[model samples]
Target: MSGAATLLLDAGNTRLKWALQQGAVRLHQGVADYADLSAWQAGLAALPAPAKAVGCNVAGPARAAALAALLAPLPIVWLQAAAEQGGLRNHYREPARLGADRWAALLGARRHHTGDTVVVMAGTAMTVDALSREGDFLGGIIVPGFRLMRAALAQGTADLGLPEGDAVDFPRSTGEAIVNGALLALTGAILQMQQRLSQRTGRTATVLLSGGDADVLAPQLQAALAVPLIAVDNLVLDGLAQLGAGDMPEQDA
Candidate 1:
């Protein structure tokens, strides 16, 4: 676990982020699009041979296959959501039905923080999950992210075209309106989850925010929540890193 780097891949809906990490230090990392593998391929050429590999493929098996072809010979442990793993218990009605990416994020969150937490992965789809102090996956809700919301509006409505704008105090233009509305909605959902988790745990919940849109959502959340917020670049990979260590979860095909 310490000598050779562990290759970690997190296949999201929109992107594939890969990293080579040895113990606590990340040796090399890069991201690439599923449709475009040039960077990923180039990265493979530049990266040293890793000792181990772990991944979660929420983008489906095709992407996993593509990655597997690239990292030929080195076997990867593609972890699925299980009843329990890495000390966190899954309380999903059907444990395997839970998204692999979300489960990984929770495992990563457990590594970073030990408290009542609202785990938010704001990506193609935003997932707001509740993790209790005792490491229980209490359930979560999913909603369209800012870009998806704006795109849906642009597609569904004739007036509101998907225009670039900023989140402001009061939006004057259609673009600004969409941007501000998305931010408000994102923060609102997070705050509500924080409140719910706090109410259930009887302790203030720390928001573990991750994914593509975390930076955009964090400021608004902090200003509104005033509770602890730990922003992670890629919690799924962190989860993969944990798996690479020794506490491997039951594999799912």
Candidate 2:
């Protein structure tokens, strides 16, 4: 696996991200909406043959099958949540019940940090997972992401539609109010979890933010928490690369 490139796919709820990696170096990376299967397939087809293709899919069986169809002739190892892998433990009562995306993100965080860390993935849904200094999975919290939050409010009410505005301190308009409120909710959740992790472990926690919306939320979270926040791109793909390199054991054949 030293000089060979591996294909890594992270089939998330709203987007499908793929990367061609040679060891730790990414040669190519691309993303497409889940609805645009053709575009994703074309992107994969354009890449050179990889040594191995590995993926973690939380988009259900239909999307999984669609991905399989696109990577014809090349076998893909679709990863799943297991009891333990890549020096990280799964604390879920039913280990397999944990989302593959979240599990992979946890493993990704462990690869980069050795201390108590909180991983926040802001995508279609926001997930905040805690990992102890010794790489123990401390479970996590899940909440509706910004888009869903806004959609819920808009769809649930007649006049209040999905607002178009950035998050502000004192929102004067309806759109601004909705956006700011959602941002606060997300940031507040991360801050609360960070505080909880510190109290429970007696050590300050490092925050790792990832996913499509991370860029938008990181600054707000960092400003609100008044602490450094690290944003990593395609964390799920990083973990998948680890699995491909045999750094982590595969789960759910």
Candidate 3:
């Protein structure tokens, strides 16, 4: 699989991230909006012909269809409950109900870590998932995303408004207050999960941060958590790329 190539795409809620790889070596990567297929086409245009495509569409089937249309003559694989192979094992009662993004992130985390791990994806939505040391796909929790929390506060309350400030200590202004409040709440939730899960497992859980808010939230979360924290960007895409490479085309790109 060293020289064999594969094309991976992840059409998530916030963005569309794609990468072409030959085994562990990444050839190219690009990101676009959910509504932007022009960028998707441009990304695909860079890839060599005869590339095996594998994708997970967490934003639903609309973008997935557009992507499939673009990859018309090529064999495009959309990960489904029963269609794929070699990713995280789905132990959920209804595997299809599980978000594809979370599943892909755990696949990457499980491959990256050794023992019991907690994958915290802080993006359009905050998802905290646990995978056993032996690769059991334990469940996870989902909460309102950071920006969504602020937006909700602004929309729900008349007095609580969005402020126009950066994330500062104990925000004095409305914007700072909203942003800080949201960040604090998100970190607090991570800390709480760490405490609760660590007590039962005894082993210090490894916290992996992914998604958009990870850069901002990791520092605050690190301060609150008793365990260690690691930030991995585009983990879901990497995972998809890994899985796609299992059966990648034999020719060099």
Candidate 4:
């Protein structure tokens, strides 16, 4: 672990994120389109030979095959969702049906917080998962992300187009209205989930935000919720590191 880095990859619906970690420090990291082979190769070429390469891919099998070809000779441990992993319990009726990204992110949240935590990943699709104080995965909500929302409006409606404006309480322009509405909807969902988690757990839940839109939505969520809102980058990679450290859950038969 000290001499060689552990390569961690999180292949999401829209993008592929990677990180190389040696001990507690991250040596290198990058993001690229999941469909772009050249971009993936370029990023992989920059890293040193890893002692172990582990990944969580929710982008389907075609992308997984491409990743395998790209990382030839370096065997990868492609993680899957289990009933439990890294001290967090998966409550899905069919545990394997849970998204690998969400499972990893839940573990990531547990690694950072010992109390009730709400994991929000705002990417191509926004996911809001609640982790109890005891590290129980209480399921979550998923909705179309801001970009998707805007795109849906632009593509579905004849008069509506993608907006290029900031979020506001009352937007005068169409762009502003669309953008603000999306942001508001996202933040509103986060706040509601936080409240529900708090009520269920009897403790104020810390909101851990990640994914592409984390930075964009953090401030707004903080202003609205007035609670602890932490922005953690590459949470899935963090969970991968945990697995590399032998924190993986037992495999189901």
Candidate 5:
């Protein structure tokens, strides 16, 4: 597979992550949303060579089908763990029940950090999955993401509101109260998970944060969690690209 050209896409709930690469070395990387694909195409058309694409979609079949249609002329590979490739053994009760986004994140986690590592993705949904040194998928936790938490509080409770600014500290106003609480809970959950992982594994695991809200959440989480938190903004796409290249060991289908 060395000389074969490749393109990787992580069509997540909020955005599209695309990358063109030769093995592990990326040539070009771009991001877009559903409305931004036309621009993505224009950018792709400007590239120099023929390429096959590998993608992981978490927005269900409709968006996946539309994405396939958009990349019709080129070879687009939808990601799935096969008996032959796409590393990281899935230990979910039902392997197929795992979310593609989580799978992609785990793959990236395993690729980026060796030894015991905890992959914490703070996106529309917060997910923390632990992987052992030898690549075992040890299970995970999921919680409402920050925005969802804010929305839920606003809709479900009286006197709760959404904040106008990005600050996630103590607030004097209703909106700020809601936002600050959400941030506290979000960061607290991540810190607790990191502590739990450390206690259980007896190995200090690296805490990695990704997804759209990572930058906003990282500082708070870092302040609280104390362990060094590495932010790899394009984790999903990087994992997709790495898996597509057959860079890691093969796994069960």
Candidate 6:
């Protein structure tokens, strides 16, 4: 089994992602929507049988049970955050309460960058976590994502129906205003977190942007960043891969 591939999954609120990793190298990667278990099943069938399958799930217990059933005899272990893992310290008041996705993302970030870091994952919810120069996960903030924010506007307001709009500084139309506003709010939150990290550490933090919306937010994020900004993919999977084979301990082991 030493040389066998390990299946890595990142189960978030909106999607299920997988990576087939053998040792330090990733052999394949893919994603599927939650509504389509058949798609995930087909995708899994096409891959090499992994020696071990591990994942981090935050989509709730019922989903985890369903996914576990889907994997069947293979038996998948869902990972959760610890006070510390892969050398990244979890400083959350309740360390175990930290989302596994965020924990895995931080672990992935540790491999991606050294120095102080501001980790951003933009998906169903956008999370911006701060890491100190010494590898302390100094917690983060979560905000409604671009689509969620826009949806909230549509749901909350009578006049602003959901319409396609581009992110622009000056919005001549209402749709443009909503779209631009969401992007600005998201990008602004990232910048603010980076600045806060820099202020506290006395050294500027590198920004590692990940998740589904990395491409959507990267251009604007890069435009406003003063420090290094790396747009990484599959951070959760990277963390899971780094994790190798493990269980979500009742407490940090």
Off by over 4 Å in 5: 81-87, 157-159, 165-169, 247-253
lDDT of 6 by residue, 1-253 (tens): 3588988888888888988998877888888888898878887788888877888888888888878778877777677788977888899999989998999999888888988999999998999999997989998999999889999999998889998888787998888888889999999999999999999999988999998889989999878987768989899898888887443442211
In candidate 4, position 125 carries an lDDT of 95
In candidate 3, where is summed lDDT lowest over 10 consecutive residues?
244-253
TM-scores, one per candidate: 0.95, 0.94, 0.88, 0.93, 0.88, 0.94
**Residue 67's C-alpha lDDT in candidate 5?**
76
lDDT of each: 0.88, 0.85, 0.75, 0.85, 0.75, 0.86
RMSD per candidate (Å) reads 1.6, 1.7, 3.7, 2.2, 3.2, 2.3
Please identify model 3 stretches exceeding 4 Å from their true place.
Answer: 81-89, 247-253
Cα deviation of 181, candidate 1, in Å: 1.2
Q: lDDT order of candidates, best first?
A: 1, 6, 2, 4, 5, 3
lDDT of model 2, residue 148: 92
lDDT of 2 by residue, 1-253 (tens): 3677888889888778988988878889888887777877776667777877888888889988877777776777888788988888898999989998998888888777778899999999999998899888988999999889999999999999976887777999999999889999998999999999999999999899998899879879878775678889988888887887876444423
lDDT of 3 by residue, 80-111 (tens): 54223354467777877778778778777866
Q: How close is candidate 2 to the true structure, as a TM-score?
A: 0.94
In model 4, state the lDDT of residue 185: 91
TM-score of 4: 0.93
The best candidate by lDDT is 1
By summed lDDT, the worst window of 10 consecutive residues in model 1 runs over: 244-253
Local lDDT at 214 for model 1: 94
User: How much does candidate 5 score in TM-score?
Assistant: 0.88
Candidate 1 residue lDDT tens string, 129-217? 99998999999999999789888999999888988888789899888888999999988999999999898888999999998999999
Tell me model 5's lDDT, rounded to 2 decimals: 0.75
